[model samples]
Structure formats: C-alpha cells, structure tokens
Target: MSNPKTKFSVLMSIYYKETPEFFNKAMQSIWDNQTLKPDEIILVKDGPLTAKLDEVISIWQEKIPNILKVIALKSNLGLGDALNIGLKECSFNLVARMDTDDISMPDRFKKQIEIFKEKDIDICSSWAREFDGDETNIVSYKKVPKFHKNIIKFSKSRNPLNHPATMYKKEVVKNAGGYKKMLWFEDYYLWARMIINGAKFYNIQEPLVDMRAGFSQLKRRKGLKYALYELRFQKELLEIGFINIFEFIRNVTIRFIVRILPKNMVKCIYKLLRK
Candidate 1:
C-alpha cells in the first residue's frame, strides 16, 4: 500500500435530537478506529444542543482538543446548511463526511484514500450495511454504482451515491454549488448537481459503514408530507436541467406510487431497487 502525506478533514453536522451515547459511538468509529486518522474534524452544531449532547462533545474534545474544531450556530440551520458552513471551515482539500449516528469501518478511510490516489476520482463512497441495535447483526446492505458513467445513469431513478459514506474534494463540491436546503432530499440535490457539472464519482464495493436502520428509518419514509418532499425534489431537478420533462413526470409518478404504498411493501421494494 502506498501512503501519501496528504491530510483530510472530517466534516460532520449534528443537531439536538441525537443522543449522547450514539454520538460517542460514532466518534469512536470515525476517529479512534480509522486506519488512516483524520487530521482535522470540523463539527457543526446546527443549533443549541442539549446538556447531554454537550457532555458527549466535551468528552471527545478532551480526547483530541486540538483536532476537534467546533462551529456552533446560534439556531438550527438544518443538515444542508450546517454542512455547507462546516465545509468552508475545513482545513484540508479533501473532506470526508460522517453522520453523527453511524459507525464507519476501521479501514474505511484507508481504502477510500488509497483509491483517491490510484484513480482520478473527485468523489468516492462505499456500500453500507444497515443494522438495528448492533453492527454484528446486519439487516441489509446498500450498494451504489462504481463508475462515473454508471453513477450518472443511475441518478435518473435513485441516488447515485451514498451521502454519509462519501468523501470528495472541497473545491469540487464548492464549484458544484454545494448543498441546497431541499426538504429531505438535500444530499440527492447536491449529487444531481455535481453529476451534471461533470464530477467523477466512484464507489468502493466494500461496505464502509454500519448504518443505523430500524423502526425510525421506516417511520420517516411514511406519510403524505414525505411524499410531497419527493415531488418537491423532482421538481427542483427538472428546473435545474438535470432531468427532461418526460423523465421528471415518470420519476414523480413512480415515487408517488411508492409513497402511498404500505410501509412493508415499500420496504420490500426498496431492497429490490437498491443493488
């Protein structure tokens, strides 16, 4: 393995609702266990956090006070804005995104960085294994396309890349116009924009993170409001020239049908849809 001297930053955003215990677990996975340690971690506090959350941050700060850079916002700015703010403050050219509640594998960063060197990659992500209370008992695995061409083509029907498991160049994302405050589809919006702008996408075939999925994941996908969010995202994509009118109508219709279906049915469909 060839190790380069280049350093990268971990850009993450956290809000008040997340628990302290989960935060600690995620930190350990992202920081403690990485074969290639992050030089800097830029954490954005979306808003005022609870005392428990503060306590968790304190513990991590105590461990690596100098490396942890906290960007505190006065009020909740949502994930997209919080991340966009954090992105600018990152000290490195390359930044890896970490969700506050997920556990990345020990060799995740190492493998991703190695690919960045051996390939002309602008963005890199990996498959993720979904788990309930534990990582050992995986519920499912999510896979995305591995090459830029396939990724662009796949964007027509679903998200081309996994957001939480993704790492990309700071300049590339910035040039692509960064993230938008689009309801629940912020990451998808950014990916669509980036793909249209000719960004190189690569997905490591390995499962890089143990994603948290259970009742909460299912619950979030139900309801009419969520369906409206899907429609809203498709409309924006149409406006941005990412999709033609024919593709837009077809996608929205399909998504709306899935949205109204029974949760269990939708779950089965999701599994079948993702490769």
Candidate 2:
C-alpha cells in the first residue's frame, strides 16, 4: 500500500552570487537522504542566473532527473517573493523549506514525516545547529513550542521555529496566504498569519540542520529597523490576545539581553548549556 503521508515537495529559493559549492552541498543533502525522496524539488532562481550557477544547476537537473523543477525569474524579486513563487509551483501537498546554504541531516525528512503522521500536524519544525566558518556549535537542542497558542507567545521576541527546518501542509500554507513580501522577517510574518488561522504546529525535539551563522544583510543593518519590525509584530499579537502585558515585557527584556551581550559571552553560555 502506498503511504499517503510520504508524498512531499522541498522548496528552495536561490539568488545569484551564492557559492556554488554550498548550493551543491545543500541540494546533495536532500537527494542523499534515503528514507523519503522528495516527490519534487522546486528551485526558484530569483534573478538572472550567473554562468557558474547555471552550470551548477544544470548538472543537478540532469543528475536528479525530472524531479528537479527550475524556475528562473526574469527580474530580482526578494527572498519572500521568490519563496511565494516556489510555494505556488509545489506539486505535493506536503511542503518543506530548505536554505541554499544549509546542510540537512540524513534522517531529517524521515523523522519529520513520522512526527507529522503521529501528531496529525499542519506545520512541523525541528531544532538546528549553527556554524561560523570552521567553528560549529549547537544553537538549540530542545523542542520549540508545538501548539499554535504557545508558538504565538514564543514568537513575540524570537522566531519560534527555524525557517529552514520547517515543513507544512500546502493547503494550510495557502489558506494562511503564503509568504508575505515584508521588508525583512518574512518567515516570522508567515508564522504569525498561520497562527492567526489556527494552524496546528509542532517541533520535533531533535537537531535536523546545520545553519550558517554570522552576519547577513538583515543582521548588518543599523537604526533598529529589525527591532521595529519585531515590535510591530508584537503589537499585532497583543491586539489579538496571543501575549499578555507581562509576557510582552518579559520577551522584550530577553531580546535586549541578547542584543547587548558580547558575542563571546553568548557563545560561552550556549556551550555551557550544551555541555
């Protein structure tokens, strides 16, 4: 008998200027995982593809056969727009998110599929580790909140689920209106919408991917634009009753501590917790 729950599609949005080696590694990790091969892999190239990237993608297209679907965008649309395009093109009912620079564990899909079946969940995610160049460390080693109510509260300050480690029901995602083209923090915005619509969410308590850390465009910005975005989202949650006054204050306090702490101290604390 065919397993209904086994059908899944992995969506990855890529932009130009990414290292071809990292891109190859990310795709290879998905293909190498044996428990459940993705029925379709949607690769949305956000803008005009570079010669090297095109060659790298062409090789994978041939190697992976027709299961790999490549969509090249004529103009550069940000990550959020590219992801929306990929989501719309996904053929399977189960949609999993992947990053162009991350490495997934071999059993990542198998474990996520098992948990989705067992919990009958609409959205699922797992813990992840972080790497800075040659140095790697466990960033999170516990379960993220599962229930919609709890997840919303958790999202008031930090992103409750790792975007690259998430899988969701396509229908649920569509109903939530898919990814929004927010200036920054598209994933968090999508999660907020999903919770608003009462989607069931779960986080399997296991490390599933190695996410590259250090500075990115969003992290490099000055003037607290990202902080303002978080504050706006928190206000929205407050209006909807997801977080109370005390919880909001607590979340803000934690965010301040994280922002003010030195990088070495934060790493030290993370190491001590993992030990």
Candidate 1 lDDT by residue in tens digits, 206-261:
89988887545866887788889888889889999999999999998888888789
Candidate 2: pairs in clash:
none
lDDT of 2 by residue, 31-70 (tens): 8755577889999999987888899999999998879999
Predictions in order: lDDT: 0.89, 0.78
Candidate 1 residue pairs in clash (backbone atoms < 3 Å): none
Give me candidate 1's TM-score against the actual structure.
0.96
State TM-scores per candidate: 0.96, 0.84
Q: Model 1 lDDT vs. the true structure? A: 0.89
